[model samples]
Target: MELGIFLLAAQFEAGDQGAVLTAALDAGCAAEVAGFGEAWIAEHHFVPYGVCPSAVTFAAMLLGRTDRLRVGTAISVLPNTHPVLLGEQTALLDQLSHGRFTLGIGRGGPWVDLEVFGGGLERYEEEGWAESVDLLMRWLTRRRVAADGPQYHFREVPVVPRPLTRPHPPVIVACTTPASAALAARQGLPMLLGMHADDTEKAEMIRTYDAAARACGRDPRGVPHAAAAVALVADSRTEAVRELRTALPKWLGLGLPAHQTLDGHPRTMRDPRTYTDYLCSIHPIGTPKECIARLRRTAEATGITRQLLFVEGAGTRERTLENIHRLGKEVLPHLQAD
Candidate 1:
């Protein structure tokens, strides 16, 4: 199994935006030094859900700082951005990073991003999102492209300065729903599963995805899907459990934003206690031995070989750094050996 760092770029009470951004990059650098294989950055807008609005730009910035750790957009919110522009920028990044970039695309959230980015959710839901993905895949892989879907119409245009990585860098999808999982399976793309689901739920979802892939005549075993969970490795189980219990609630609160949309649409409210139970049930948050057990259990249940750890959010930079280091030194090797 391989471990990767999942950065949320969360803003806490300190609210030092500069320091927070710097710490996020520093954490990636630290993860690279700690021997992580990949670093995934998430994109969000108009809220503290995620401060990094441009994941591709952030991936480029991280590439400049680290040498070997492959950087990826955990998702680049396809519905919110233009396919051509995203393709161009991603192709450039692929060249600049020496084919060390991965493109993880997803439909925009139901939150404020669609409205704020000038397209309504209805259009994206109808056809816009799928069309954007199709156009992006064509732009990255083919020389000349023509897209005349319901939501997008374009003549045959060359994807100038084509991606250095043949067939383009690995394109993963953030599969949130069963439909999205099936779509990814049909496309033969890997998926990034969120941390919200329990082990049983995740395993069932993966089974559904694999079955769908097989139904579409694709080899399900070849698809590499990653399951994410908030991880905090500590010296002792007691210490880790205490810290996680306290931070989990705070993190859940941040996941659901406090503010409303322009027309007064409220964020999805979550009870911390309920969310905490769901989180702890799936996450590996304990001593090295305990964490390893949880990770192994998850792998066994879901048949997922890669686990992305959410190491930063609602904690001191120092605390987050320690968690990263512990995960690398203590938790990673055992899992790798297995």
Candidate 2:
């Protein structure tokens, strides 16, 4: 299994924005030096989770800072923008990063992005999302393209300055549900799970995603499955547990904004009241060995090859950096060895 760093990009009450991004990049630079595979960033508008709303733009900035570390968007909700423009932006990033770009797409969160953009949750339906993806792939690949569809459209125009990377950049999809996973499989797109599901559920979700691909007559191994997860690794289980407990409610606060659109539309109903049991059930947090055990068990149960760990959010930058270094030093090698 390959491990990657996923910064929560949560706002810091004490620091400047440049410092926040600089700290994140510094940590990512360290992770690359530590031998991680990818540095996955997420995108969200008007959300405090991490203001790097342009994961691709962030990746562009990080390109010159690191070598041998791939960068990807854990996801960019595509329904909010045009396919051609999205393709253009990512392709430029791919060129700038020397082909180290992977496009991750998903329908924006219902309670947050979708409602704000006037897009519906039902748009995540296999057919519609898949069609949008098809259109994206088409625009990314074919030089001369033409299309007139319900969700998206295009004309037979010559797309110049084609992607620097061959076959355009690889595409990934964030699969939150069984149906969405199935859609990813049928489309042969790699599926990336989110940080909200725990060990058992994440494992099951990956299996369903892989199975869906295979059922679509595609090679299961060809479709990669990755999960974004919250992690806390420490020298002692007691310390890990304590920190985990202290940070649980803060995690809810961090995520609620992503659920609430920029308009603060209350769409996603998550009871921040029962924060512990609910958050604990989903986030993977503990000592090195404990974290490794959950990771190993998840791999055995679901066959996930890669996962991005959410290492920053509601924690001091120093603490987040320390946890990430410790994770790379302790937990990663053990899991990879297994």
Candidate 3:
């Protein structure tokens, strides 16, 4: 089992953005020293959901900071950027890292990302996501190619600075629906699933992906797929859950534009009891022992060997660091042993 840190780069504190970024970078370095295999950064714009606007730039910084940790974008939104530019930057990063970079691509949503970065809602609705991805893959793998897509068109051109990794670095897609999983399998690519999914959903998704891969003459079991979920490991379940109750609402509150608020108290800071209950029902939050049991069951049920632990969403700098240490030192070993 490989342990990966999902760096949210969350702006939990609105007062000091610089401190938040520094803490996130510090956590990345700490993760490398703590024996984590990979550190994945997320990209978000115009909100505190994630402060990092360019995951590629952050990945480059993290790769420079760490010696052994593999750095990847949790996802770099594809529809919003030019495939050729993305391919060029990714190739450069891969070369600099000595082939320690992985590319995770996705069509991000909640409607706003597309609305803002992707021109507008109308454009997003009519956009050809698959065609864009196909063009991207071509640009990454081939030396000379032309993009022939609804969104992009170009004459034959040579893409310079071929990736250090043969045939390009591993490319993974973030999958949420059955269609997305099938698309990944068809492309002979692995996937990244979210933590919100229950054991049953995870297993179902794996099955769906495997069947699709098989249909395409690809081996799904051999493909490396991973899942991410909120993680907060503490000395006691009470302490862990308490922290969760406080952090979750604030993070989820970014959905206020959709009229779906996590912490409804506009003036209040604390999350409501019902909100805490809802979070507990969805995420894996508890003491090390409890988290161990939960993770074990998830593995047993879903047969997933790789997981990205999300520790930065709702914790202070000290607490997040402590949880990461405990995860790598205590929780990881148990998971590996079992």
Candidate 4:
């Protein structure tokens, strides 16, 4: 199993943006020293949920700072940006980082981000997403590409610099729903399952993805799908749960409610307290032994070998780093032994 950190760079309080960003970078650097294999950065706009607006920019900086740790965008929202520009950046990053970059793309929410970025609501819709992914894959895989899709129409252009990773730096789709999973499967790409869903839910998604891939005449068994989960290692399960319960809900409360819809379509955010409790019940938030057990079970159930741990759920630099170190020193080795 491969273990990595998911850097949300979330701001728990107002006017702490610098501190939050610095801490997230520090955590990325610490991951390398702590023996983790990769670090994934999250991107958000106009919200404290994730202060880093550009996951690719953040990833480039982190890639420069680390030698071994593979850096990826937890997702660079596909609808908000041009696939060509993103493709160019990802290719450059892949070459510059010596093939240590993964481009994870997703259809972001119907947030005001689409409005701000000029993507409009249609880009957030299914047709737009499918077109974007198709164009993106062509940009990554071929030397020269042209697009005549409804969302994007462009003349043929050469893929400059090209990608250091053969067939392009691995592109993973961030799948939150079965439709998203099926879409990724059609392209024969792996899925990056989110933390909000539990083992059973994730397993169902894997089944969905696998069936879809097989239907499309693509083998799913060799694909290394990833699963994200909140991880906190402490002396006891009680202590871990208590700390996360206190810190995570506050962060979630301030962050989740900040998302505004572009269209007047009603958007209902999850209840922070209930959601926190649910994550705690499903994830590895306990002693090293307990954490290992939970992660192992998740892997066994989902057949997912790549795991991204959202270690910053403790909501502070000190505690987050502590959790990362504990995970690297204690939990990681045991899981890797399997």
Best candidate (score: TM-score): 4
Angstrom error at residue 186, model 2 = 2.0
lDDT, model 3, position 12: 62
Question: Clashes in model 4: which pairs?
Answer: none
- Per-candidate clash tally: 0, 1, 0, 0
lDDT of 2 by residue, 1-338 (tens): 88888874666453586777777877778778767888877787866556677777777766778878898876787776667778888878777778887888887665456665665654555566777777778778878767787666555887655788777788888877888778777777788887667667877876787677777788877456787877777766567656656665565666564555445556754655465545545555777878888777777666776878877743667888888788888888887786
Model 3 vs. true fold: TM: 0.90
Best by lDDT: 4
User: With candidate 4 superimposed using the best TM-score fit, by how many Å does residue 159's alpha carbon deviate from the native?
Assistant: 1.4
- After superposition, the stretches of candidate 2 with alpha carbons farther than 4 Å from their true spots are 12-15, 111-128, 254-265, 273-284
Q: Model 3: per-residue lDDT, tens digit, 1-338?
A: 77788987887656687887888888998998788899999987677767888888889999999999998898998766777788889889888899999999887654456545653433233246676667778878888988665677789999888888878788899888888898899888888987667778888999999999999898877688888877788778787877777876766665223321223323333344565565566555787788778777777788887889888845588887887898888888877776
lDDT of 1 at 202: 84
TM-score of 1: 0.94
Candidate 2 whole-model C-alpha lDDT, 0 to 1: 0.73
TM-score against truth, every candidate: 0.94, 0.87, 0.90, 0.98
Q: Which ten residues in a row have the lowest lDDT in candidate 3?
A: 256-265
Q: What is the alpha-carbon RMSD of candidate 3 to the true structure?
A: 4.1
Candidate 2: Cα lDDT at 243: 69
* Model 2 alpha-carbon miss at residue 1, Å: 1.1
